[model samples]
Target: MELKKSTQKRHQLLNAALDVFCLYGFTGASLDDIAKRSDMHKSNIFYYFSNKEALYIEVLTSVLQKWLESMQMLNVDEDPEEMLTKYIESKLEFSRLNPKASKLFALEIIQGAPYIQTILKGSIKKHFRGKVKVIAQWQTQGKIAADISPELFIMNLWSITQSYADFETQFEVLIGKTLRNRSFYQTAMKNNLQLLLHGALVK
Candidate 1:
């Protein structure tokens, strides 16, 4: 239908925008670059977005939504080890598959998140607090260490997993292999799970 095609075209635009933004950062990226990347005329971008800022916000919002969805796997009722394992794997998988998107997000935050600060403080904060409450519930259930700070634990997990994307060049230099390799990915998942779970899981 027309709606389906419209949605598809919107997604194509967002995908192209993501690549351009990641390569050039927000200030450096231009609508012409995104249009060229999407193989559409620059004027066509206005059909879906009001302006360059609007498109950039949409692209950033989409990436953040995907990142938050990865954490939805966590459940207080599930075994802590199993849930944490799945969470770590999901995050790492996202980093591996969408490294550029991950780096773009990191760059946004590093630059003080000028465009998405409202979203970060509103929906993103609420979502993060909900997950922290889940972690606290796990601790109360004696699933993880009571002494572990839920906020800090979540922050650390995010930093470590996202580092693989935001610092891919450094990782490549040190590991001598990209995460594209199955072996490297497995090693990353295993080590991340171990490093994280070892400290938090109740003995």
Candidate 2:
């Protein structure tokens, strides 16, 4: 029963950490907030993690792992268009299903990630470069537009797609409806996805 209690406590801490970090950001959030959210004591948080920064990193790592897992679910070959289409869908789906994680990630990145900058520039860089290289390979093989720079194209694509998740509140307030529920928005997504795959790459 001791081990069971330990496991439960660990899970509880993780869940609480996610909520606090997502809502308050790493710097904005306090250990008190995590403890209250998790229904555990601040001292207990220390028992599991050395500091708030460490716990925040763990939460970010967990969120990153889930995003990477989503990427791993699809084959990145055979049909570049379909492959990329599904990939975008997966990312959007994750945003809808895991908005808090998205917000946390966006917040960390927006602040320059003082605590996690090294990890972002290191392992995360390698991971992103790997994917970018794949897109470059596709461009070289005529699978994507030969004219578009893989890096710029990807940056734009991500910016456009993640806009819904990152700026939904503002976007919705302006449009008076959610981007997720609109047909025009859906078609726009389909069109933009195709725009990258269509003439941008070939005749």
Residue range 14-116, candidate 1, lDDT tens digits: 9999999999998899898999989889999999999999999988898889978877878777788888888888899889999999999999999999999
Best by TM-score: 1
- Candidate 2, TM-score vs. the true structure? 0.84
Model 1: how far residue 116 lies from native, Å: 0.8
lDDT values of the candidates? Answer: 0.91, 0.76
RMSD of each: 1.1, 2.7
- Specify the poorest-scoring 10-residue window by lDDT in model 2: 70-79
Query: How well does candidate 1 match the true structure in TM-score terms?
Result: 0.96
- Supply every candidate's count of residue pairs whose N, Cα or C atoms clash at under 3 angstroms: 0, 3
Q: Which residue ranges in model 2 land beyond 4 Å of their true spot?
A: 1-5, 73-77, 179-192, 195-203
On the 0 to 100 scale, the lDDT of residue 120 in model 2 is 80
lDDT of 2 by residue, 100-161 (tens): 77788888888978777887888777777777787888877777777778778766766666
Model 1 spans with C-alpha error above 4 angstroms: none
Total clashes in model 2, counting residue pairs 3 or more apart in sequence or in different chains = 3
Alpha carbon deviation, residue 199, candidate 1 (Å): 1.2
